[model samples]
Target: MAKRENIGLSRELRQTENRAEEEAWQTLRLLRKEGWPVRRQHQIGPYIVDFAITKARLVIEVDGGIHREQEVAARDVEREGVLRADGWNVLRVSAQFARHGDHLIEMVRAEIKRCCPLTLHPSPQGERGT
Candidate 1:
């Protein structure tokens, strides 16, 4: 539960991500390149989320088939509740849906826009303007 342990666990999770997570990560990487400060296997409080946009207080979870089980679903609900209580918006994407990288990007973009629209805009000279 310590910060050091969370960092180690996050590193392991990043290295051993499932296929769906990998697909989502690829799309998230694109978002990062576009100036969205996205992080993978990011830790939030005591939980390690699949992806997080810290500035937007958003956490994105790619739910696999195992999440369909009743027990896992219940736990997920509890987790989401805790995150929501802490002012973090949770977005759950099915593993099947994550396979579509374009759709995943769009979903994340919409969530970010809805929660925290980017303040910076590009100027005509390719510089960032507030």
Candidate 2:
């Protein structure tokens, strides 16, 4: 269950978030249908990630125009470093990717696979099972 404050904050963010954010959210919903188990505006540690797959320890960030600014870019770099040090895989995507199409899901899936490869189980016959 989410805390009341975080729930309220997320609601407020949803209402005020830019079009890119809203669109990215829709894409994330589609990814969920594909079994990614991602959450929007999820809080992790001291910051809020645009989307997170806790079980996978993946954090997704959607960068808008403001992200291009020097200060924001620097902050983002620092934040990502912290997350990485904490053993979280951070994937950053441009909001423009959302405007174009649903390719974001594929990209995220690939990143997940790269960051956390699935361990194969052994078959009864001593073969590897995918």
Candidate 3:
């Protein structure tokens, strides 16, 4: 269950999302329609991630110019450490790359495949039940 505070924060964050995040969300929505089960502004632990594939334990962060600041980058590193310790894979994409529709979707798809290849594809008949 999502914490009360995080839920509110997520709501606020969603409302103020940057252009890159908006583009990423559009791609995520398409992936969801294709059965990828993506969620936007999802709460995980004490943080609300930009996008999450819960089953695959993947967190996608669309970083804008602000993320390049030293303080923000440091905080991001700490947050990523915590999430990784909890067994999550974090993928960060720059605002510029994320704003490119095709590139963003392709990158996300590649990450998903890397994280959960077996679940996404069936074993060959000869390899099955081996």
Q: Which candidate tops lDDT?
A: 1
Note the residue pairs that clash in candidate 2: none
Sequence-dependent TM-score of model 1: 0.87
**Model 2 segments more than 4 A misplaced:** 1-7, 119-130
How would you encode candidate 3's per-residue C-alpha lDDT over 77-111 as one tens digit per residue? Answer: 99999999999999998888888888888887888
- TM-score top scorer: 1
Please say which candidate is ahead in lDDT: 1 or 2: 1
* Model 2 root-mean-square deviation: 6.9
RMSD for each model, in Å, please?
4.3, 6.9, 6.3
Candidate 1, poorest ten consecutive residues by summed lDDT? 121-130
lDDT accuracy of residue 94 in candidate 2: 87
**TM-score for all models, in order of appearance:** 0.87, 0.79, 0.87
Q: Give the Cα RMSD of candidate 3.
A: 6.3
How much is the lDDT of residue 57 in candidate 1? 82
Q: How would the candidate models be sorted by TM-score, starting from the highest?
A: 1, 3, 2
Better of 2 and 3 by TM-score: 3
